[model samples]
Target chain A: MAELSKTDQVEDLHLVNLTKRFGEVAAVDDLTLTIPAGSFFALLGASGCGKTTTLRMVAGLEDPTSGSIRIGDKDVTRLRAFKRPVNTVFQSYALFPHLDIFENVAFGLRRRGVKNIKPIVEAMLELVELGHLARRKPTQLSGGQQQRVAVARALINKPDVLLLDEPLGALDLKLRRQMQIELKRIQTEVGTTFVHVTHDQEEAMTMADTIAVMNAGRIEQMGSPAEIYELPRTVFVANFLGQSNLIEGRVSGAGEMLDVAAHERSFRLPRERSSATGASIILGVRPEKMTVLDAPDAARVPEGHNVLSGRVTDVSYTGVSTQYLVQASWGQELVVFEQNLIVGDRCEVGDEVVVHWSPRHSFGLDGNEDIHAGVDSAVLALESVDSAPAAGDGE
Target chain B: MAPVLPSAAVAPPSTVAQRRSRTGYVLLFPGMTWLAVFFAIPFVTLFVTSLQTPVPGKSGRYQLGLEFGNYATALAEYWPAFVRSFAYAGIATLLALIIGYPLAYFIAFRSGRWRGLMLVLVIAPSFASFLLRTYAWKTILADESPVTSFFNALHLLPDGRILNTSIAVIAGLTYNFLPFMVLPLYAALERIDPRLIEAANDLYASPVTAFRKITWPLSMPGVVAGTLLTFIPAAGDYINAELLGSTKDRMVGNAIQTNFIEFRDYPTASALSFALMAAILILVFTYIRRAGTEDLV
Candidate 1:
C-alpha cells in the first residue's frame, strides 16, 4: 500500500481497458475512463448495462479479468480492497448494525489503527447533518439518515475517490430527489472525485458533471449532461436520455446548406450539423422543441421551419406542459410537448394539427440503427420475465 | 392524518377485538396446560425431593420436609464431580465453537450448491442412538484401536491408553454436540448480508479486521445460541463419562445417576440435579449478560 501522506492530495480515478467476464458473459468489456480529480462523474445505464459492474471494478470489490485501475500515479489493479485508497457508499448502506452511528462513521479510521477519531467523525457527521444522531444505531435512523451516514462513513476516510452504487435506490422518489441535491452539495464541499452509478437519467443529468451512457457492456456516449441531451450521437443515446422524435430522411444537398426529404416533405438542416450528404439519416428532435398548431392555421409556420401536418392522436395534460401525439398524414406519430399557458387552446384527441420546429432544434442519427435500441433494458428484462407466466396462462 | 374519533363510537369495535383476544388465549390453553402438567409438575416434585428427609435406615424412603442439609451433604461429598462436570462441559463447548465456527462459515458462504448436502452431513450423526455413538468413540479411543495406535506411534499420546480418561469424555461430548453448535452458527452467519463484509473491506479494513469488527460481532447471536445448546446438554450428560471415563473423571450426572438407580438415595440425587440446574442457569444468565446478547432470545 502507498503511504497515506503521499495520497493526501486529490487523485484522478482511471480505469484502463477493464474487462470483467462472468462465465461466458462479459459484464463490463474494455471500459476505459478517466474521472478528473474532484469531478462528479456518473455512469448511467439501465439494469444489466454494466454500470454497477464498472463501479464495483473501480471500487476493488470485483476483480477484472484483464486491465488495470489507477488512482493518480499508483496502479491499484492487483491491490486488495483494503489496501486501495478508495471507499464506497453501498446501495444497502451496509452500515454496521452492531455499531452506533459515531462508531460506524469512525470504523475506517479505527481499522487503520488511528485513535482519537471522535472529532473527525463528528465533523463528518455534521457535514452530512447527522451529528445529532451520532449516538443512535443505524437501525434507529430513517433510510435517508442511514444513507447520509453511509456517505459520511466513506467521506471521513478521505479516499482519493468515492464510489456510490445507486445510493438512492432504496429511497422514495421525494427522498431520492432531496438526497440527489444533498449528494451534490457534499461532493462540492468535500472536493472528492465521486463516481456515481445509476439508471436514473434525471439523476445523472441533475448531479453529474460528466455522464457516460453505457449499453451492452460498452459506452454509447460520454459528455456533459447538456451535450448528451442536446446532441445524442447514437439512436440509443438519443432515445435513452429522453424522448426523441426520429424521422427517416435522405440528405439531398451538401455544403453551406443541407436539405433532407422525408415523408414527401423537404426539411432544411443547419450546415454545421450536416452528416454524409448522400446517406439516409434519422432526424431527431426533442418533444418540447416541436410546436403543435391547428391544421387550419398551417400557413402560420415560418418559411425556414420544418413542418408536418398531422392529427392529434393523444393529448395529455401534465400540469406545466401538455403532451400531444401527432400522427402525420403521410405516416408515423411524433410526440410534442407544448407549454400549458393557454388552457383555452387545449386540443382533444382526433383534432387536426400541424407539428413544426426550427432547423436548429433537430439532430441527425444513422438511419440504419434500431430506433428502439436505447429503450430501458430494465423494462425489456421485466417483459421477458413476465412472458413465461403470460404464455402459461394463454395455454 | 385522520382526527381522533369519539371513544363511544370505537367502544363497540374494541369490544369485539377484546373477545377475539380472549379466543386467542383460549386457543393457547391446551399447550399451556400440557406444559404445566408435564414440565411444571415434575419441576415442583424435583424441588420437593431436593428438600426431602431420608429415613436413617430405610432404603428409598424419604419424608417430605425442609431438609436443606441434603444439599450441604451433596455438595460436601461431591464437590469434585460438580467442578469436573462444568470443566468438561465448558472445554467441550469451547472446542465445539473452535471447530464449528469455520465449518459453519464454510457451509454458509463457500458451499454454494453443496450447502444442503453439507448441512445434511452435519446433522446426519444425530440419526443414530447417542449411546451407540458414545460407545463407538469408546472403541475408537481404546488402546488397541488404529487411531490410538497411530497417535501412540506419533508420540502424540504419552501413553497408549485413552479410553478411560477425561480427554476421552471431553472428546465424546464435543463429537456428540458438534451439530448443535454448527447449525445455529450457520443460521446466524448465513443471515448476514455479504455486502456488509465487502463494505468493511472498502472502508480499508483487512479481512481479519473485518471479521473481528463485523463478522464475529454479528455472529454473536449464533455463538451464544450454539454454545448454550452444546454446553447445557453436555453439562447434564452422564453417558459419555460412564462409557469412556474412569472414576477420577466422573461428572455430577454420573453421581446423580448412581445415587438414584444404585444407591437408592433419592434425596441426594435430587439435590445434586437441582444444584447442577441452578448452577447452569446462573452461569448462562451471567454469560448472556457479559456477551451483551440478552435481546437475542
Candidate 2:
C-alpha cells in the first residue's frame, strides 16, 4: 500500500464544455463536469448514452471536438494518451495476451524507465491479490481475476484519475456483486479517484459515492446516490434509476406544501421537492415508498399522509415483499410494494384498497416532459405494469 | 401392468464407448490412406533409391545395393549449389518479410473500407501462372528494359545489368512467394485486438513502443507461418534460377534435375534430392525451435 501511494496530492478532473461528434450525431454533446478528487464516482446510463464517450475524452483516447480538459491547474486538452497521467480499465479488460500477469502489471513502470521494476511489479501483483498467478497469461485467468489484473495495471501507474469503462460488464451476476465490493474496498484503501461507467443502477449505488445519471449524451442529474434516487430532477433520472409512479396533476394551492389535484383526488407535495413552477405538474413517488392497505384498515393510515383510493388489480409475491398493482379511480394503475411481514391479513387481487404515502416521499417534475421518456419499453413489455422495481431493492 | 424388459437387452456402456472410438478411427481412414499411399510410399522409395549403386558399365541404371558413398560424393561435388540455394532462399525470405509485413499491417489496421479490395489485390497475382509471372519479371529486368536503364542511371547496379545474376534470381523468388508471406502475416496481424495497443498507449507507451511490445509479439504466429511458407518452397525451386540466373548461379534443384534428365545419373540425382530435403528439414526444425512457436506450429 505504501508503494502504491505515488501521488501525494489528488487532483480533480475537469471537463469543460466538451463535445464529440461522429459525423452528424453528437456522441457527447456540450457537457461540463467536475469530478472531485479521491471520490468513487459513477456515470450511470443505458447503452449509447455517451457515458463511455465522456470517459474516453477524460482519458485522452477521444479528442474533444471543442473545449478543454484540465487536471487541477494544468490543461490536458491536447495531450496524447501516453503523455497524460491518466489510465483506463477498458471494457474488455484489454490485458496483453502475450504478457503474463507480472509483465502486464509491470508494463507501465517499465515504459516510464523505472529502474527498480521487479519490486514494484511484485508489490502491484500482491495489491490485486494475484501474486500467486503472476506467471499465468491473461487467458489463463478467470473473468474476475483478469478484471483485478486490469485494475492493478492501471493503478500501478498512480494515475491522477482512474477511468473504468464498464469494467464489470462481462462477469456473471454473482461475481459482479462480489467484484463491486472488492472494487469499493480497493478504492478506499488506495484513496485514488475512480470514475466508473456502467448501465447498472444498483452497481452505481453500491460502489459509487457520487452518481451522475446520463441520457442521450447529456447529464440529467448528478449527486450522491441517495440524493439522486430520492429527489430526481428529471423524468429520465426517476425512471432510469428505478421505477417511479408518476401521476399527472395540477397544482391547486402553493405554500410550504403544494396541494396537487389528480382525478378528483388531492395529494400534498412538499414545496421544496417540486421543481415545476407551472400549474400543471407531475408528482412522482417510488413504489416501495407507498403502502397499500385494505379499505377496512384505512383508518390506520397516517393522519397527514396523501391518500388515493383504488382497487387491487394485480398481486405479485416476491420473496421479501408482495407487489400490488392498484388501479386508481382515475383509471391509472399505481404499483405499491409492501414488505411481507404480515401473512394472514394480505389483500388479494380485486379487493378495494387505499394507497398512501407521506408528502416528503413525493417529488414533482414538469408536466411538459413526456411521461414515458425514460421508461425502457422492453422492460415494460416484460412486466406488463408501469412501475415495478427495475432491479433488486438497494435499501 | 406393463412388463419390464430384461437387463440383458441393454447395451453395456463400455461397448458403446468402444463403438464411438471405432467410429472416430473410421472417419480418419480416407485421409490416412491417401497420405500413406501417395506421400509415405514415394518418400520411402526415394530414400531407398538414394542409397543404390550404379550397375557396372550400364548407363542410367542402378542395382539394389547399399552405397552410402553416394551421399559423400553428392555433397562434395555439389556443395556449392547447396550453399548457393540456401543463401538465395534465405535472402529472398528476408526480403519478402520486409516488403510484405508493412503491406499486411496497413491492410489489417488502416485500410478500413478498402481492406477487401487491398487483400484481393495481394492475392490477384496468384491467379496467373507462377511461371508466366517469373517470365514477366525476366522481361521487366531485361538488359535493355526501362527498369534496368533506370537502375543503371542511378548507378545502383554496379554490373550495369539486371538479368542473368543472383539479384534477378532472388528477386524472382521473392516476387513469386510474396503472397504466401502477405496472407499469413495479414491473418495474424488482423487477429490482434486493437484494445491491447490502446492499453499499452494508455499505460504510457508511445506508439512505437506499443507496436514493439504488443503488436510484434502477438503477430509472431503469422510471421513464423509466413516465413516458413516462403522459405521452404523457395529453397527447393529451380525454375527462377533456370530462367533468370546464369550457369554459375544454379541451385541444388538445377543440379538434381540435370543429373536425372541430362546425364541419366539416377543414383546421384536421388542422393542430391535426399541431401537437400534433409538440409531443409534441419534448417526448418532449428528455425521453429529458435522462434519459440512450438504451441503455434
Candidate 3:
C-alpha cells in the first residue's frame, strides 16, 4: 500500500481527490484544489454543476465518499462539522429567528465559552453598519440587512476560511450589486480566505481574484478572472463565462506567419501559441474584442489585423452598448459588441459589414468540441429578460 | 391636474354593494346562534346554578339565590382533590413532554421515508375507544401480569402493585395524551428549516448545543401548544382516576362527577366545575405570558 504524502506547508485549504456520491449520482466527483490563504476565490458554474455541493463538502456539512480535506496542515477529513475552523453564509441567510441581532452575533463566542462577548458582538454589529438595530429580531430586518447580519455572525467567529454559498442570491438586483461591493470590501479588510460559490458569472467576475469554472463535477478551467476570460482552455469555459464567437477553421503554415482558413477568409494564429497545429481548430474571440465597420470601409482595416466581411443579421440596442449578430461569409453568426458612439446612427439589420480584430484577441481550442454548448441557454436567458420587462427594469 | 370625482359617483353604488354583502353575515347566523344556545346559554346556567343554595336541610333540592358561600364550601371540602388534580396533570404533562419530544424529534428529523408510517402509529391508538385502551393497561399491569412480575423479578417494584394507584392514573394520563404532545411538537420541528441547524453547526455549535440553542427554543411554540392541549383535558378527566386510582388519588373531576350523579348535589358540582375552569384559564394565561409566546395562541 502506498502512503499518502503529508506535506509541511500549511498556507491554504486543500482538498485531495474529494468525491461525494449520492447513490448512483456523483454530485461532486474526484476534485482537488488548493486555495491560497487570504485570497478571494470562487467556484463558478451553472445550477447543478456541483459548485454548491463542492462548497458544502469544504464546509464539512457533507462528508466525502473518498479522499481527504485539510485546512493548512491539519487533516480534517473525518472531523465533525462543528469542530472545523470554518463558517458559512448560507444563500438564504438562515438567521436565528428567536435571537435579536446582538445575541445572534454573539452566538459563536458564547458557544466557545467566552463569557465576555458584548464588546466583540457590538463591534461586529457596528462593522456591518447594523449597530442601531442590534435589539431587533431577525424577522424585523429587511433582506439586505439580514444578509449583512449573517455575514457578521459568521465572520465574528474568526474562522480561517469563510464560505459564502450565493450569499446575495436572495437579494434584489440593485441590492445584490451593492452587496457585491460590500462583500469585496469586507474580505479585503479582514484578509480572510473567502470561497464564494455562485452560478452568476457577473457576480463571480466582479468579486473573485481567482475563479474555478466548474462543469459536470469537475473544474473546466481555473485561473485569474482575466486569464479565464481572455484565454479559456475549453469550449465550455469560453461560452459559459461570457459570450464568445468560435470560428471553425483549418490551421496551416502561411509563410512568415501561421494562419487559419475558413471559407477563403484567413486569420492569424501565432505559432508559439498554437498547441494543435496542422489540424482543424476553433478560433474564439470575445464579442467586445472585435470591431465592426461598413463593408465599403475596407481600407479602414488596420495592418496585421484579421478581417471578415459579413452582413448584420440582428442588432440589439442596450443603452450602453449595441450587440450585433453578423452572418459572416464563413457560415457562422459572429457576435460583435460596440459602444453606442452615436445612439441613433446604429447599423441597421442586413447592412453589409466587415469585422476586424487583432491577432492576439483570438483564442484557439480543439475543433472536435461542442460548439453550441452554452450559446442557446444564454439566448434563452436574454429572451426571458426581454419578455419580462420588470426583470430587466429591476436591473 | 385631474378633476375630483364627486362622492355620489361612488357612494351610492358602494352602499348598494354593502347591502348585498350582508348575506355573508346572514350566512353565519345559524352557526353563531347554535353556539350561543348550546355553549353560551349552558355556561350562563352553570354560573347561576353554582351560585344557588340547597333548600334548608333538604337533600337534592336547591333554590336559586346569590349564595357565594357555595363556592367556599366546595373549595373548603375538596381542596386536596383540586391540588391532586393539578399535580397529577402537571406530572403527566411533563412526562409526556419528556417522552414525546424525542419521539417527535426522531420522526421529524430522522424518520426519512418512514415518517408518515411513524405518524400513523402515533395516532393509531386514539382510533380505538380511549376507555378500552386504558382498560387494556389495567390488564397489562395486573398483579400477576408478566410486566409486573418481570418488574418484581428485576426488583424495580418493591410491592409489585401498579394497578389502582396514583402512578397508574398518571401513567394512563400520559399515554392517553401522548399523541397530543407529539403531533404539535412534530409540526414545529418539521417546519424548521434543516439549514438553520446546519448553520448552527457551521457557526461552531456542537450537535447538543445546536439542539439546545436552536431546536429547543424554536420548538417552544409547539411545547406551549402541546402542554395546553394535554394539560387542560387531563385536568378535567375522571375516567383514568375512576378506572386506575383509589379514593386517595381522586381528582376534582371525580368529586364533581360523584356529586352531580350519585349524591345529586348540583350546586356543589357546578361550583367545583366553575372553579376548575377558572383555575385552568388563569394557569394557561400566566404560562403563555411567562413563556413569552403569547402570539402563538
Candidate 4:
C-alpha cells in the first residue's frame, strides 16, 4: 500500500507534507500533492476543505507552517510571493482601478522594471482578445472582459505557475462555461502550470486535466475527472461528485474472487480486490450505471454478477435524459438515468422493473461489517415491524 | 450596474438608469454650487485684492488704487517671515510624514476595531479647542514643567529651557496636525486591496520590496493630502508663535496679524493675507495636481 510513496511520478508543483494552522485549528494538514505541468489542475472541494488554503500557500499568500513547495527543481518554501515564479488571478479579479486594461496587464512587468513591456503586454492582451478594449478603464469593462484582463495580467508576467482562485465563479453560467473552455485552451497554448481552485464540480469536470477532490481538510482523491467520477475511492467522494446509491453488503465468500451478500441474496464481486471474506462493504454505483430491465432479472446469476427487482417510484425529465427512482427488493431506493430522444420508450412512474448493473460498476469499502448488518436488518424488518403494532392491538 | 428596471426599446417608459442619473444630478448640484461659491469666489477675490494698492496719505489710509506696490512691499518687508514659515512647515510636514506613516499603516493594515478607535483618538484634538492644545504644549515645554523636569533629571539640557523657541512652534504645529496626516494616509492605505500586496509577495517581493512597490505607491494619495494639510495650516499659524516663541521664530501669519491688529493697517494686512494666500494656492495646487489621485482612485 505504501509502495507508491517511494516513487516520484508527478511533476508540475509538488507540495511536500504541507501544513498550516491558524491559532489552534489546522487549515491545511500534512497535505502532499503533485500537480503536473501543462495540465489544468483543479483543486475541487467544498468550503473549508483547505483547498483555498493550499492554493494560497502556493500563491504565497499564506506561509505554510511546515513544508517545501517546489516548482520544478526550485524550492520556493522561503521565497517571497512576488519572488516566486507564480501569479494569481483572484476570485474577484482584483483589477487595479487606476489602470486601463493595457496598464493593468502591464502592472507585473512594470513592477519588475522590464526593459521592453509594450510588445509583451500587447501580445498578452491579444491572447485574451482584449486588444480593442485596452484603453478602457476597469470600471467600464464588463465582468467577462475584466476576467480576461485578470488572466492577461497574470499571464503577461510569464510565470512558471498561474494560480486561478475561482476565476469564473463571478460569471453567469453561460459565460462561466465559455470561460472554462477558454481557460483550458489558453493553458494548453502556453504550457504553463495552472492551479485552479473551484467549488463547482462541473467546472472542474469540463476544464481540468487533473482534479483533486478535497473534503474536511484533506484530499479525498486526486485523479482525472473521469477517474474520480467513475472510480471514487470513498463514499464521500462518490456522493460529492454526483448522485450515487449506497448499498450495504458483506463479502460472504472469497478465494480467487469474493461473494457479496445483502438481504437473502449472494452475489459474486469482481476478482481484483484481495480483501478477505465476510468483510463489511458499502457498494457504490453511479445513477447512469443502473438500467431498468423490462423482464424479471435472473435471481441467481452466475458468479461475478447480481440482480434485483424494484418498482419505479418516480420519473423526471432532465431534457437530455430521464431519471427513474426505483425501490429495490431490499427497500433501498436507487437512481437510474436513461437517454431521452425526441421519441423513445420511457418507463413510467409505478412500473415494476428489474434494476440491473454490473458488479464491476460498483465500488465497495474494504471493511466494517456492522454497517451492512445494521442496514439489512432494519430494512428487512420494516414491513413486519409495522404489522407488529397492529398484531399487538388484536391480541 | 444593474438597472432597477429594464429599458425596453419599443415601449415608452421610464428606466432606472435614466431616473438614477437625474437624481444623481440633483444630489450633486448643491455641493458643486457650494464649492463654486466659497472656494472659487475667494480665490477670485484674493487675486483682485492683490492688485489693489494703499493710496498714499498722512493718515495711512487708502482707497482702491489699482497698483501692485502693496504686494511688492508686503513681500519685501515679510520675506524673512515667509522663508521661516516655509522652513518650519517643511520640517514639520517631513516629521509628520515619518511619524504618521507607521501609525496609518498600523491602523489601516493591522488593526480592526482598534483602527476606528485609534482614528478617533488621532483626530480628537481637533474636536477640542485648537488654541488650548497649542497652549498646553507651551506649558508642557516650559522650564518649570514635568517634561523639563525629566530632561533635568537626565541632565540632558544644561538650562532645561524649552519654551519661547522655534522648536516649541514646530512641536505645536506637528502636535496640532498629526491627525490630518494620519487620516488621509489611513484611508488610502485602507482602500489599497490587500490582495495586491499578497500578489506582489507571491511574485517574490520581500517585505521591504512589497512596501516599496505596492504599499508606498498605493498610499501616495495620503502622503500628498497629509503634506498639504500639515503645511498649509502650519505656514499660516500665528497662535503657536505668539504663545510659545520669541521674535526669531514668528511665521508669516505673525507678520500679517501684527499689521492688522497692532498697526491698524488694513491695506497692509489685506495685502499680506492675499500674498500668503497666493503662495499657498501655487504650492498646494501644484502638489495636488501632481498627486495623481485620479489614477489611483
Candidate 5:
C-alpha cells in the first residue's frame, strides 16, 4: 500500500537563499539551487569553501542561519535531520563499527519501528552489490565495501535526496576512480538525486550532471559539466575549470561583428554586440585553440580572426601531445597545446612559431554572462550528464 | 672536533630489548606469584573455611570441619542481614545511578571545564574519609543537631531523627560509592560519538528514541563498569552499616565483622564473608551481562 504512493520516485530538492554563518564568516552565502528529481549533482570547491556546509544544510544536519529549503515544494528548512526525507553517506562512511552490514543498513528502518526488515535489508544489500557481505561487521570490511554499505543504509530508507559528502574521499586513487564510474552508474540506475560534495575538480566534473563551482563561501558559477568547462562565466570559473589564457585587450571597433586585439594580432568576437567601443577589455583562449601556424600562413594572419605570432620558448612531450610555452608582447607567456602525432615533426626545445586561433575560440577574460541566472542548480544540470570518455568507459 | 663521532650508539638496542623482555617476564612472575600466594590463596582458603561448624559454647564462633551444615547454619543465622545488605545496596546503587548518571553525562557530554571541577568535588568527600562523612550525617540526623530543629519545625519527622536507619545506611553507602559510579559512567558515556545521536535524530526518530536506540545502547560498557564499581563495594561496605544502621538495617558485612572481631569467630566470619561475596558476585555478573546486549547504542 505504501509503495503505491511514491511510485519508485525520488523527490527534487531546492535550497533557496541558503546562508549559514558561523560568527562572522558565512560558510554558505546566499546559495540558491534546485536539484531536479533523480540527478547527481556535485558541489565542488577547495577546503573551507562551503561545499560541505551546503550539503549539511540540505540534510537538515545543520540549519542555515537564514534560508528556506524545500523537498518537492514542501518547506523543510526548520525540519530536524531525522524528520527530513534525506540521508547522508559521510566521507568516512561512519558505519557503526559495532553493526554488521545487515544491521547497519537496517538501522533507519528499525528506528522507525518498521516491520519487515529482512526483505527490505536484503533488497538494499542486493542493490549495492553487498548482499554477500551482509553479515560482516564494518570493522572487517574494506573501505569500498564500507562505502557500499553506507550507500545501502541511506538508500534503504528511500530518502528523497541522498547527500554524499565526499563519499569516495577515503578510497585509494584506483578505488576512487572505480567508485566514480560505479557511483555515476548507480545514480542513473536508481534514479535517486545525489548531491555529492568534494574538493576534487576532476571527480566533480567527471561525475556530476551539473557542477557548482564555489569559492570563498559563494557560488562562483554552476552549469552542466561541459558549460562549466568550455563556457565558464567568471575568471574564477575559467581558471578553476581546467586551464585558460587571459589576455588584456580592447574592442577597437563594433557592429554586427566586433574586432578585438591581444598581444600580437586583432581578432573577431564570437558574438557581435553594441557596447564599449575602444574600451579596455580582456580576452580568453583555451590552450588547445592556439596552434603553431607554420611557414606560410604565419605571414598574413587576418584581423578579428585566426592569427598570432609568438616565439615558442619551451616544449614538453606528453604521451599523446606536446605543450609549447609561447612568449607574447605583454611579457606573459601563452600556452599552446600541439598535437604530438608520431608522423609530425614536433617543435624542439626552442622555436619561433605563430600561434593562431579563430575568434570563436576566444572569449572575454572577464566572464560575467548569466552570472545572475542564480548559478544553475548543479542538481538540474546533472540531469543532462554525459561523462567525457574515461579510459574504460568507451569499452 | 669538539663532538666525538657516535660509535654505533643504537646498534644493539634490539638485542638489549630482547634481553630486557626476558628479564621483564622473569621479574613479572614474582609479583604474580605473590598475588597467587596471598590474594588468591586467602580467597580459596576462606571459601574452604566457610564449610565449618560453630563452636557451641561461643556466642558467634565456629570451627572448621568441611561440614556443609555450616553454610545452612550461616544462612539461617544471617539470612536477614544478607537480604538487608542487598536491599540497601540495591537502593544505594539505584540512587547512585540516578544521581551520578546525569552528573557523569553532564561532564562527559555537556559541561566542559565544569566537569573537571565537579569530578574533583565528587572525589573530594571521599579523600577526607567516608567514615567521617557518615559521622557528619550522624550529627545532621540526630535529635541534638540544627537539622533536627529544622525537621521538627517543618513537621517532617515526628521523632526528629534519621540516623541508625535503613535509609541512612543507604544514603551513606551511596555517598561512599558515588565517585565510583560517576567516573566509570563518565568514561563510558564519554566514549559515545555525538554524531551518532545526531544521525539517529536525523533518521525520523524523535530525540528520545534516538537516545534510547543509539546513545544509550552504545554506552553499555560504561553502565556495566559503573554499576559494578558502585554495587560491589556497596555490598561489601561494613563501615556504613556499622555507623549508620541499627540491628534491623545491619548488612551481611556487619554480621561478618561482628563474627570475626567482636566474637572472634573466624570460621563463622569466613562463612558469612563467602556467602556475601557469592551473592554480590552473582548480582554484579547478571547486571553486567544483561547490560551488554542492551546498552550498546
Candidate 6:
C-alpha cells in the first residue's frame, strides 16, 4: 500500500484527435477523449470497435496515425511503450511463461533498476490475494489466479495510468464477474487511473465510474454508466448499452416537454432528454422502464403515462423479471420487462396488453440513423466471448 | 446382487484393459524388432569387436579373446585427434548458433510472408550431396579462388591459403550443419507468443532487455536442440576433414576411418567409435541437465 501511494500526483489521460489506420481502414478514427484522474473509466464497445486500439495507443504499444496523447501536462505521443508512464494488462494476460509469478510482478521494477523489490512485490501480490501462489509459473495457476497476477504485474509498476485491454475476456462467466469486482477493489486501493476496455455492458457498468461507448473507432457517448444508459445520444449507444424499444416518431411540438406522434398516437418526451432538433425522431425507452398490463387492467393505468396497445408476442419468465415482446398495432415489436413480484398476474404469450411508461423514462434520438445500428453487434458480442484476437486490436 | 453387479462391471473393464495392453504390445512389435535387428545387434557386435585383440603380426585379423587394452591404446595414441574433433565441433556449433539465431529470429518474428521462402533457402543447400557441398567449399576456398585471394589481399589468411587448414574444415562443418541449427531454433522461436514480448516491452523493458528477459529464455529449447543437432554429427563426421583439411587438422573421425579402411585395424577403429559415442552421450547428458530442458525436450 505504501508502494502504491508513491504515485502521489494524479494526472488525467487525454487522447486528442487520435487516429490509427491499417492501410485503408481506420481502426481508430479521429477520436478525442479525456479520462479524469484517478477514475475507473471504461471504453465499452463490441469487438473490433477500436476500444482496444484506443487503450493500446494510451499504453504506447500502438502509435497513432495522427494526433497526440498527454498525461497531465506531458505530451507522450512519440514515447515508446517502455518509456511511457503507462502499463497495460493485455487481453491474454501475456504473463511471462518462463518467470514465476514473483519475478513476473517484479519485472517492471527490475527493468527500471529498482534496488529493493522484494517487499514491494510481496505487497502487490498480497493485494491481489496471490501471495501464496507467488512461486508458481503462470501456467501452473488457474485462469483467475493468472489474471490477478497479470494485474499485479502491471499494478506494482504504479504507472500514472493503467490500461486494461479486455483483461477479463479469457475468464469464464463466474470468474469474469469475480475478477471484475476484484479488479475494482484493487483499483480503488491503488487510486491510480484505470482505463478498462471491454465489450460487456454489465461489466463496464458494475466496475467503471465513467463509461465511453465506442463505435467504429469513435466515442458515441461518454458519461457515467447511468447517464449513458439512461440518456444515450445516438441510436448505436441506445441499442448497444442495453436493449431499447425505439419507436419512429415525429416531434410535433417542443418545449420543456416535447410532443411526439407515432402509430397515430401522441407521446411526450422531456425536452432535455431529446438529442434531436428536427421533426423526425426516434423515441427510446428501456424495457425495464415500461410496465406491461393486461388489456383488462388498462383502467387501472395511472395518468401522465405514455400508453401503447399491443399483443404479447413473447413471454420469457426469467426468475427475477419476466420479459415480454409486445407487437404494437403498427406491427413494430416493443419489449417490456416486469418484475416477477406478483406471480398470478403474469401476462402469457398472445395476451393483449398495454405498455405504459412516464415521459421521464424516454429519450429521443435522430430518426435518420439506422434503428438497428448497434442491435446485431450487441447480440454478437454477447454470443462470442473472447473470440476476438488477443494480440491484434481492432483487426 | 449389488456385489455381483459391481464385479461384473469391473471384470469387463479389466478384460478390456488387458486387451488394450495386448494390442499395444502387438503394435510395438515391429518397431522393437526393427531396432533389435538394425540398432541393438549392430551395437552389440561393435561392442564385442572393440574388445577383440588382433592376431599378432596379422593385418586385419582378430582373435575372439577379450582385449580391453584396445580401448586404452586407442585413447592413448589418438587423444589429440579426439581433442581436435571436440574443439573443431565446438567452434563450428558456436559459429552456427551465432549466425543461425538471428536468421531464425528474423524468420519467426519479422519475415512475415517471406518466412517460407527463407526457410526453404536454409535447407536448399542440403539438397546437394553433403560431400558435394564440402567439395564445393574446397573449390570456393582454394588457393586461386576469389575467397582465398580476397583474404590474402587483406592479410587475413595466416599461411596465404584457406584450404588444407583447420579454418576450412570448421567452415565446412558449420555450413553443412547450419540447417540443423536453424530449423529447431525457428520452431521454438515461432511458437513463442508475440504478446509476451509486447508485455515485456510494456513493463518498462527496452527492446534489447525484452529480448534478453523474454525472447532468449523462451527460445532455450531451440538453442539446446539446435546445438546438439549440429555438434553431435559434426564431431563424428570425417567428410569435411578428409576433403578440406591437411594432416595437421585430422580429427578422431579421420583416425577411425584410416584405422578401419587403410590400416585394417578393426579393434582400434571399433574402440574409437565406441569412445566417441560414449563421449558424446556424456556431453549431451550434462548439457541437457545444465540447460534444464528435460520438460521441454
Q: Please report the candidate that would top TM-score against the real structure.
A: 6
What is candidate 2's local distance difference test score? 0.90
lDDT of 3: 0.86
Per-residue accuracy of model 2 over B144-262 as CA lDDT, tens digit each: 99999999999999789989999999999999999999999999999998988989999999999999998998899999999999999999999999999999899999999999999
Candidate achieving the largest lDDT:
6
| Per-residue lDDT of candidate 6, residues A162-209 (tens digit) | 989888887777677788888888888888999999888889999999
Residue A117, candidate 2: how far off, in angstroms? 2.3
lDDT of model 5 at residue A92?
Answer: 71
TM-score of chain B of each: 0.93, 0.94, 0.91, 0.82, 0.83, 0.94
Q: List, residue by residue over A1-395, the lDDT tens digit for candidate 3.
A: 01111111225999899898999998888999999988899998877778888888888899899989998889989988899888899988888888899988888888888776787788778778999999889888888888899999998877888899988777767777898999998888777889999877888889999999988788888999999998887888888888898888888885645688878888896665444444788888899999998988889999999999999999998888899999997668889999888645677899999999988888788777788776554554344323422211221
Q: Tell me how far candidate 5 lies from the true structure as C-alpha RMSD in angstroms.
A: 7.0
Query: Root-mean-square deviation of each candidate, in angstroms?
Result: 5.4, 4.1, 5.4, 10.2, 7.0, 3.3
Best-first order by TM-score: 6, 2, 1, 3, 5, 4
Report the poorest 10 consecutive residues by lDDT, candidate 3 chain A: A1-10
lDDT measured at residue A124 in model 5 versus the true structure, 0 to 100: 71
How many pairs of residues in model 3 come into backbone collision?
A: 0
Give candidate 3 regions above 4 Å deviation. A1-10, A253-258, A271-278, A340-347, A376-395, B1-32, B56-58, B295-297
Q: Could you estimate the TM-score for every candidate?
A: 0.92, 0.94, 0.91, 0.83, 0.85, 0.95
lDDT of 1 by residue, A51-99 (tens): 8988888888999999899998999999999998899999889989988
Going through the candidates in order, their DockQ values are 0.54, 0.60, 0.59, 0.42, 0.41, 0.61
What is the docking quality class of candidate 4? acceptable
- Model 6 chain B is weakest, by summed lDDT over 10 consecutive residues, at B1-10
Q: Sorted by lDDT, highest first, which candidate order results?
A: 6, 2, 1, 3, 4, 5
Local accuracy of candidate 5 as per-residue lDDT tens digits, B113-229: 687787788788877767788888877667667866777788887545767767678888888898898898888888877876766665666888877776666776777777778
By DockQ, the best candidate is 6
Higher-ranked by DockQ: 3 or 4: 3
